[model samples]
Target: MTKNETDERRAAMALLAAATARELDSAWTAWPERPAVEDLRKAACGLVMVRGRIGGDGAPFNLGEATVTRAAVRLSTGHIGHAYLLGRAPERARLAAIFDALWQDVSARPRVDTELLAPVRARLAAEAAKAVAEAAATRVEFFTVTRGDNQEAAS
Candidate 1:
């Protein structure tokens, strides 16, 4: 895949991974047609070593371990999709993988975006905006007025 394809795939996968199980299942239920999907890798849960960098620029270190579930699916059209998500929601992982493969098809991409990605993107955007607004509402500005005597002394 080209760089753009890789980027788009990455973004689609992230959006899928962010989706709640109910949302994903609903999207699957709304599919106009079901393409045969083969499980390249069955959904499984495991632990991964979480790593972090101090201030995002310092040396990397192991933060902790997190539970992650992963799955891979191959569509009839030959596209393969993979997913790794936090927590043990195997069904969600499988659905996400299936959607990922579906999203690979240029013709199916628009439908996938509308049925799954677009709504999720809008909801997430609104949520983020609400959070920002809430934080902004609590913002405080600090300022000082110079004393007349101090101004005179400086002059």
Candidate 2:
């Protein structure tokens, strides 16, 4: 896949991670007909070593281990998709993998992008904006004044 495809898939996965159970269920329900999906790798939870850097480009180090659930699904049409969710949400990981496979299809991309991703994107954006506004509301600014000889003499 090209860089664009990789980026698009990454963004789709990110949005899928934020999708609610209701949203995923609704997406599945709304489909006119469901394709046969095979679990190449059933949803399973495991620990993965988290890596971090002193700075973004600094040397990498193992931060710690995090619980991650991952799954892989293959559409009847032969498209394979995989997902790794942050927590042990089997249902979410399974649904996300299925959606990832669906998004790969040219015909199904529109529906997946609209019905699932759009709502999640909107919700996340709203949440981020609210957080920024809340933080701004409580924001403080500090400044230091320089004392001059004249001020000292006056005192």
Candidate 3:
């Protein structure tokens, strides 16, 4: 695959993983059957340091630490999958990793994309749009008005 295609696939997998367990469960019902998965590493919770940069371009600094759950699994056919998720939802992490592995399989990619990833992507986009609209509604605009003295000075 080309670089662009690889990047796009990675992005799609990320979107699939962002789905909540409820969403995944709903989508999974539509799937014909679940692929067999073997847990290489059961889900475990750990701390990761969150980092940020001042003004998005300045020196980076540790913002804080966040709790994350991670898991690793292998498909019956030998594909490996891994996931890292914020908070302590081990089941979600496992499910996400399974989806990730399934997504890598060419035969499974279409089904996973259509039944699982697409809906999640749409929902996330809709939520983001709503947030942007709500923030826009409260937006404040500022302007400057020239006083008589300033106008005279310019003249």
Q: Identify the leading candidate in terms of lDDT.
A: 1
Q: For residues 1-155, could you state the per-residue lDDT of candidate 2 as single tens digits?
A: 89999999999998887787788888988886889999999999999999999787799999999998899999998889888888888888899999999999989999998899998999899999999999999988887565675676543
Q: For candidate 3, which ten residues in a row score worst on lDDT? A: 26-35
**Over the stretch 1-155, how does candidate 3's per-residue lDDT look in tens digits?**
79987896788767855889897667666656666789999999999999999999999999999998999999887888788878898888888888888777889888888888888889999999999999999999987666767787553
Clashes in each model (backbone N, CA, C under 3 Å)? 0, 0, 0
C-alpha lDDT of residue 151 in model 2: 75
Ranking by TM-score: 1, 2, 3
lDDT, residue 10, model 2: 99
In angstroms, give how far residue 32 of model 3 lies from its true place: 2.2
Best by TM-score: 1
Among all windows of 10 consecutive residues in model 2, the one with the lowest summed lDDT is: 146-155
For each of the candidates, the C-alpha root-mean-square deviation to the true structure, in angstroms, is 2.4, 3.1, 3.1
Best first by lDDT, ranked: 1, 2, 3
Question: How high a TM-score does candidate 2 get?
Answer: 0.87
